[model samples]
Target: MNLRQFEVFHAIMRTGTVTGAARLLNVTQPSVSTVLKHLEAQLRFRLFNRIGGRLQPTPEAQALLPDIDAVFSRLAAVQRLTQDLAGGRLGTLSVAAAFPIANGYMARAVASFLTGRPGMRMALQSLTTPQVVDRVASREVELGVVHEPVGSTEVDTELLLRSALAAVLPATHPLARLERIPLAALEDHPVITYLPQNLFRFHVDKALAEAGISPRIVAQVTVSLTGIMLARHGAGIALVEPLMLRSLDFPGLVARPLDPPVAFETVLIRPRGTPDSTVLARFVAHLRDVLRAEGLLPEGH
Candidate 1:
C-alpha cells in the first residue's frame, strides 16, 4: 500500500522470515512485524502464515509479488538515474553549432567527452550561425558554438577563440609557393568562400576592399569545410578560418595565412537566464582544452 509496506513485504517475500526481512531491510524484527501487520490491515487480507517458527506467503501475497517487483524495479531505475545525474554521468547534452565548429573542433571535443562519460547522451546539430543563436535563445539547445556574431538579449556569448584566417589552396596551385597569400593576387584567380551574408564573408570583402583588390568569386559555400573541399578539388583558393585547418587534415589542401593577417573569432553561447548545468560546464571545459591543444584557442582559455 505504501513504500515502506511494499519494502517490508518484498523483503519478507525474498527472505522468508520476519527476522531475516528485518536484517535485509536494516530494521528491528518488531519494526518489520509492525509494518507487516499494518500492511495486511490496510489490504484487509492475510499476507503470510506463521508455521514451525518460519513465515510462508499466502495466495494474495504470492499474487502481489509480480507487481511489487515491477514497482521496485522502476524505483531502482529512477534511483540510478538520480545518482548518475548528481554525479554528472548521465543525461543528454544538446549542442547546436555552426557548420565549421560542428564539422571540426566541436566534433572532436564531443567524441572525447563521450569517451569519459559513457552514460551520457549527446545531440549535436549542424546549423547556420543565426540558427544556432536562435536555438540557444529558445532553449532548444544547451550550448552553441558559432564563428559569426549573432548575439542577442536572450543569449550570452563568450569569446572562445580568435583565429587568423587562412588561404586553403590546392597543393599544385602556384600561390601555394608563397608563405603568405597576398589578397591582391587572388584577383587573378577565382576564390571560394563563405556566402555573402556570412560575417566572415563581410570581413573578407572589407579586407579585399582595403587592399584595393577585387577577387573573382567563383563559388560561395555555406560552411568552411565545403570551401576547403572545393579548394582540395582545385575549384579555387578558399579563404577559411584556421580552426578547421588545425583539426582537419586535407592532404591536397595547404593552408597559408593572409598577408595582412585577417582574423576571425568563435564564440560560445548559452541562454542568458538559464542555470549552468554540470554536464554543460564539463563539456565547455573539454572543448576549451581540445581547442587549445589544436592551437585554435589560445593557451589558458
Candidate 2:
C-alpha cells in the first residue's frame, strides 16, 4: 500500500521467516507481522502463505517483486541526482546575456569555467538587455550579464566592468589615422549602429545627443557582430565596446577609442531573493578575472 509496507513485504519474501525479516528491517517481529497483515488487507490479496512457521511467497508477491525493485531503483537514482546537485558535483547553469557580454566575455569565461570544472554544464542564451532582465525576473535563467543599468528591485546586480567604447571604422577611413575619434567628426558620416532597442545603442545615442551631434543613421543591426561586419564593409563607423572589438579580426576594420571616451558598464544580475550557488559564484569570479586580464575592467576592480 505504501513504501514502508512494500519494503516490509519485500523483506519477508527475501528472508522467508518473520523473525528473519524483522532482523533485516531492524524492527520487532510483531511489527513486521503487523505491517504484512495491513498490506495484505489493503491489497485484498495475501502476499505470502504461512507454512511451517515461515513465510512462503505467493505467486502475486513473486510477480510484484520486479515492479517494486524497479520503483526502488528509480527512487535511488533520484536521490543520488539531488545529492550531486546539492554538493555542486553535477548540475547545469542557465545563463542569459546581452549581445556583447554573451558573445564576447561570457563565452570565453564559460569555456574556462567548464575546462576547470568538467562536471558542470552550461546553457547560454543570447538576448537583448530587456530580454536578459525578463529571463532573470521570470527565473528562466540562473544568472545574467548585461550592459544596461538594471533598476529592478526584484533583481540584485553587481558591476563587473566598465569597458571603454571604441569607434570601429574601415581601414581606409581618414578618421582611422587619429589616435582617437572625436564625436564631432562622426556627425557627417552615416552611422551603422546597433538596433535602437539595445542598451549600447541607447548609450551611444545619449552621448551623441549630449555632444550636440545627431548621427546619420545608415543602418541598424540587432547584434554587435553584425554591426562590426557592416563597419568592415565600409557601411559606416560603429560605436562598440572594447571586448567586442577584440573578438573580431575583420581585416578592414580598425578600433580606436572614442574621444572623451564613453564606457559601458557590465553588470551581473540574479534574482533578488535567491542566493547564488557555489557554481554560479565561481563562474562570476572567472568572468571578472578574464575581463581583468584582458584589460577590460577598471584598475583594481
Best-fitting candidate, scored by TM-score:
1
TM of each candidate vs. truth: 0.71, 0.67
Runs of candidate 1 with Cα error greater than 4 angstroms are 1-83, 242-249
Q: What is the C-alpha RMSD of each candidate to the true structure, in Å?
A: 4.7, 7.2
In every candidate, how many clashes are there?
Answer: 0, 0
Question: Model 2, residue 204: displacement in angstroms?
Answer: 2.1
Per-model lDDT: 0.86, 0.82
> What tens digits encode model 1's per-residue C-alpha lDDT throughout 1-301?
8899989999999999999999998889999999998888888999999998889899999999999999999999999988878766887899989887798878999998898677999999999889999999999999999875675889988888777778998778899999998888888998888888777888888889998988888999877888888888878989877557667787877899998888877788899978778888878888999877876667766
Residue-wise lDDT of candidate 2 within 13-108, one digit each (tens)?
A: 778999999999899999998988888888999888889888788999999999988877898899988876666557789999987778877898
After superposition of all CA atoms, the RMSD between model 1 and the true structure is 4.7
Worst 10 residues of 1 by lDDT: 240-249
Clashing pairs in 1: none
Candidate 2 colliding pairs? none
**Model 2 TM:** 0.67
